[model samples]
Target: MSTATAASKTWIRTSASIRAYLQLMRPANIVTAWADILAGYSATGLVMSEQTWPPLLWLLLATTGLYAGGVVFNDVFDAELDAVERPERPIPSGQSSLKGAIGLGIALLGLGIGAAAQVSELSLGLAIVIAIAALLYDRFSKHHSLIGPINMGLCRGCNLLLGVSAVAEQTQMLWFLALIPLAYIGAITAISQGEVAGGQQRTGVIALLLLSMVTGALFGLSFLPSVQGWNLLPFTLLLIGLVFPPFLQAADTPNADMIRAAVKAGILALIVLDASLAAGFAGWPYGLVVLSLLPGSKGISRLFAMT
Candidate 1:
């Protein structure tokens, strides 16, 4: 072969490898982590000013690392299962090596915790707990239908708190608000368990109920003395517009493709849900910033499956 041909071949191989790693990380799903950071800021009633950027950047780094690391670790642990049920996945498809995936996961986990530590001791501690919860879910909890959802939900809730911990005051409301994501994500994860084949209608109903709790909580938050003046109606309506339809459709038809679509809708609409929370506690402007991620994530989703 000519030198140019060899060089082109090498470039193609390198590009393919990079794509595999990105797939392992599931960047579209990872974008949802930004919800945690903004919600954390909202919980604190902190305005989005220039000074906020420094700490916000740290939280973003921490959340991105942890969320990406968790997805990578899950892929690593599920490699054998994927080989059987999902042979096209990066690890099983030979595009990404198992050893490489594991190494990247471990590195990202450490980088996440270390980055949070740069922000504050509380953030670091929360990051460590989040990492452990994620690891356990990947190793053990995933097989147990009930525990798996709870574990995943808690991880997301911790992601929110990881951002809250950056604040000095750490209000009780922030802690209380964390439960919304916990309930919502837990329910979503439960429903996702059946996406590959089919899920029970009961499970789908329960997931819808869980989502109700989160939305209801957001509605109630509008009544709070701190957030009384700003109208949260638009935010709530937008969330319902984005999230409610697919889940309702999934509840009626619990087939493999339908459930998977439901799962993907839930994951994608998470930005809208998070934006509602941000708007409820903070203001509409910050919520708009969170909302922007939804369309941006569509680009990521095209590159790889969010599920």
Candidate 2:
């Protein structure tokens, strides 16, 4: 081949490979991790100002690395299953190697903890704990019906705390708030198991409603005074609109395609959850910034898998 032609082919190959790795990290899901960190800031009443920059920046690094690593490792562990169920995935399709995924995951996890260590001992400690939970969930507990979703939820809950605790001690209120995402994601995870084949998911629908009700209860009580002038009713409505619409759309049939739709929606809806929390607890501007990620995440999802 001509030199230019050869270089062109090489560039194409490299671009394709990079896209595959990006799919592995699942950028849409990563936005949810960003929400977790933002919620942490909101929990501690840290506004989106210069004063909050240091810890917020570090926690962002730590959570992203840790969350990305956990996801990468999940693919590593699920390679065989994906081969059968999702053969188009990067690993089984040969777009990326198992070894490369492993290396990347470890690097990200290490980067995450190291970033946390830059913040404070408590942050480092929480980062380690979440890392352990991620490892356990991916390696051993994922197949367990009860343990899997709970384990995943714990990772998210700690992620929120990882942000809050990075700069200051977590209050009892923050602890309570963390459980909202935990319950939401855990319920969604429980529903996702049937995505491969799909079927009636009445229980999943009910679970979603119950979780929403719980979150609504918290909003109703006005347990926070961090953000002002954001109406509770409208915020609650927006939260429901952003979060439950996809799941509700899929509820009628719960078939494979619909279930996949719900699963993907649930994954992206994490940003809405985060935005809702930030709006109610931090400020509407913070919530708006978090919500703005939705478009970018959607744009990326078109190029790669979100779930």
Candidate 3:
């Protein structure tokens, strides 16, 4: 074989390997993490004008690392289950080795925590907490009936809070607001499981609705005078209004697809609300909101269409 051909083959193999790794990280699933961080930052209403790039970069890297850790470790813990439920998964299918997954998990955890440490001690602390929670959920909590989703939700909530707490002084209200996304995370977790189980329970649907409402309320509260302006009241009301119909529908039928659809719609509404909050706080007029929502809507639409 020619030297050039050999090099091309090598490159192709490398590229394919990297793609598998990325899949293991589950990039599509990290949208909720992004939304959580965006929501937390929006609540603060304090966008840095001069030194924004540094914090934003740190936040992105840390979040990506942490999320990667979660995915890798979850696969490691679920290897046996995946053999039965999802043999095509990375570990079960031999697309990625178990050792590779565990090593990657540790590396990503370190990178995430290190990146957050660069931002602040508080951020670093939160990163550690999140890492621990992810590990616990993957190893143990995931098997527990109610505790699994709750633990997963808290992990996501902390991931968002880590971003905000990294940039600004911590607030009590921020902790309270974190519960909103926690609820959404719980709902999503339940829905994903329901789909796998081939049915949905009314209790699960009710839990999801309560979580969605809390999430909307928290988003609205972030725009209050304490954070931004009372003018945001209209936007908050609109978000809550947009969020309710889907939940009501899902409440009756309680299917996996319906729950997923409701979550998608809720995410779209959040993207809009957060972008608006970011704009309101940053003194930009509508540009950020438009930019954020367009891609978000497209992504969510594609995700649900597949399901």
Candidate 4:
């Protein structure tokens, strides 16, 4: 073979390998994770101005690592199952190695904690908790129908808190808000259980109920002086429009494809949920910043799987 041709082949191989790792990270989901940090930071009533940008930047990087790590470990733990049920996945398909995935997961998780440590001890603590919760869900809790969703929810809840910890004092006052994402993610997790074999109608119903409660909580927050009630309405309605239809369809059909569709919509709609929260806490501009993430996430989702 000619030297030029060999180099071209090498480049192609490297690019393909990089794509595999990106796939493992679920780039679309990572984009949604950024919205969590943005919303959390916004909840503190802090401006994302030049002076405060450093901390916000740190928290965003922290979540990127945390989310990427969490999902990488998920694929690591599910390698055996994927080999049978999802053979197209990177590890199962030989695009990425299990040992490499483990190393990547650990490094990403460590990066998450370290980045948070740059912000404050409190942020570091929350990052560590998120990492632990993610690993627990991936390795053990995911096997249990009841505990699985809650465990997954815990990771997302703490993730939002990680953003709040940007201002140590604000976190103390706003800690309870984490429950919103917790409940929302819990519903998503519940619906995700049926991705392969199809979900139960009751499970879908329960998830829908949780979603409703989450919506109610977001709406109730609008009544607070810190939140702009009108600014929140558009994103809240967008969220409802994005998630409810798929979830309702899954609830009615309870089939594999519909369940997958519901799970995808829920995961992607996380940005919308966070945008609503940001708007409620900060203003429409900040909320729009959060909502802007949706397009990139959607574009990437077309290339890589969300669930």
Candidate 5:
């Protein structure tokens, strides 16, 4: 082959490899992590002030690394299962090697821990814990009945807390509130597993939805007394309203359609939650929320179109 052709072939291979890594990480799912980070940051009420960017950037990096590590580790543990259930995944599909995935996961975990250490000792500890939880969930909890969802929820809740601890002076109450998303994650994970395992179970899906709503409501109520006025109410209502339709729909349908709808609802709930926090601090939460939703909405729209 000519030199130019060889170079072109090399470039194609490199591009394909990059795409495989991205898919393995599941960038679409990372949206939930980003939202949690933002919500945590906003809840701190620091993002509104002048001294925001440093801790914000650090926490962002740490969270990204943590998420990347979790994604890779999950794939590492699920290689065999994916071969049976999702043979087209990066590992089973032959686009990426298990060894390479494991190496990348370990590197990302190290990077995340290092980044968290720069922020605070507490955050560094939380990062390590989150990484361990991810691994434990993938390896042990995933096959269990309800333990899987609980593990997934707790993992996400920790990610949110990591962001909060990175910038906030106190995070006890906020950390508790962060567990609200855990309920959401747990519900979604359980419902998803149900869909894959067999057909569907309305009772389980409904129970999960109720758990999510209750969690969200509890978080909202906890913040309400601290928030002075009606400013927070609108955002809370928006979030609750946004979450309700999808939760109901998912329970009613309980299939792939429900899964997609649930994803959209989760994305919207994150936007509302973040915007509420921003508003509680800055009084202009709607604009920031809209900005956050634009890119996500476009992506989801494209995904729906393709589907």
Candidate 6:
């Protein structure tokens, strides 16, 4: 090939490589991770404050690394499985190399920990825990029917706590709030199991029940004295509206495609759930700010898979 032709081919190869990595990172799901931090920070009543950007920005970056690392490792670990069940995935389809995916995962995880360390020891510790939980789910727990969902949930819960670490006292007092995401993500994970092979109606029903409990908790939290002025009802109702139809449909159909749709809706609805939490703690304005991420997340989901 001539010099110009060779250079053009090299540029095309580089562009394709970049797109493959982005696919491995699942950018749309990473947006939901940022929502976790915002919701937790809002609970500290510091989301919109003047000093918010410094720490909040770090946490957002940290979650980008953590969530991206977790999902990348997921694809890495499942490369063999993907070749069999999802031959179109980056690794299986030869769009991304396995060795490069491993390197990317390690670097992103280190970035997650390093960014959190810049915030505080508490944030660092939570970031470490989140990383460990993510690895656990990716490597071991994800294979277990009972532990897989809970392990994934723990990663998300600790991510929320990483946000709370911005305020030491609030972190101590409000750690229990992490359980809400735990249950919500756990239900999503459960629904995800059916995404490949199809799941039973019983599994979908269980997920719906768990989601209902999560909604109830969100509504109850809004009634607390500290959040008395802001109403979480609108956000909570929005969450219900976003998630329920697909969830119910999946329960009725229980097919791989329908289950996948339900899982996608659940994952996207997570941003709405985080918005409700933010609005409940800080007020509707901040809640709307968090909710604003949804449009971008949804748009990206169209290009990159969210589940």
Kindly list the per-residue Cα lDDT of model 5 for residues 163-185, writing each as its tens digit. 78865465766666656667766
| lDDT on C-alpha atoms for all candidate structures | 0.83, 0.78, 0.66, 0.92, 0.69, 0.90
Q: Which of the two candidates, 1 or 4, achieves a greater TM-score against the reference? A: 4
Please state the error at residue 253 of candidate 5 in Å: 3.1
lDDT of 5: 0.69
As for candidate 4, its clashing pairs are none
TM-score of each candidate structure, all chains considered together: 0.96, 0.92, 0.79, 0.98, 0.85, 0.97
TM-score of model 5 (CA atoms): 0.85
Writing each residue's lDDT as its tens digit, candidate 3 over 92-173 gives 8877788888899999989988988887778888889999999999899977668887998889778768757855555445
Candidate maximizing lDDT: 4
Candidate whose TM-score is highest: 4
The TM-score that candidate 2 achieves is: 0.92
Model 2: lowest-lDDT 10 consecutive positions: 224-233
Error of 1 at 252 (Å): 1.4
RMSD to the true structure for each prediction, in A, is: 1.5, 2.1, 3.9, 1.1, 3.3, 1.2
lDDT of 1 by residue, 16-118 (tens): 9999999988899878898778777776644555567777788889888898899899989999999998899999999999999999999999889888988
Q: Mark the regions of model 3 whose C-alpha exceeds 4 Å error after superposition.
A: 1-14, 43-46, 219-223, 228-251, 255-307
Estimate candidate 2's alpha-carbon lDDT, on a 0 to 1 scale: 0.78
Of 4 and 6, which scores higher on lDDT?
Answer: 4
lDDT of 6 by residue, 101-167 (tens): 9999999999999999988999999999998999889989987767998898899899989888988
| Per-residue accuracy of model 2 over 160-230 as CA lDDT, tens digit each | 88878855555445676657767777867767777787756774676577567656764754655554535
Candidate 5 displacement at residue 83 in angstroms: 1.5
Q: Candidate order by TM-score, highest to lowest? A: 4, 6, 1, 2, 5, 3
Q: 1 or 5, which is superior by TM-score?
A: 1
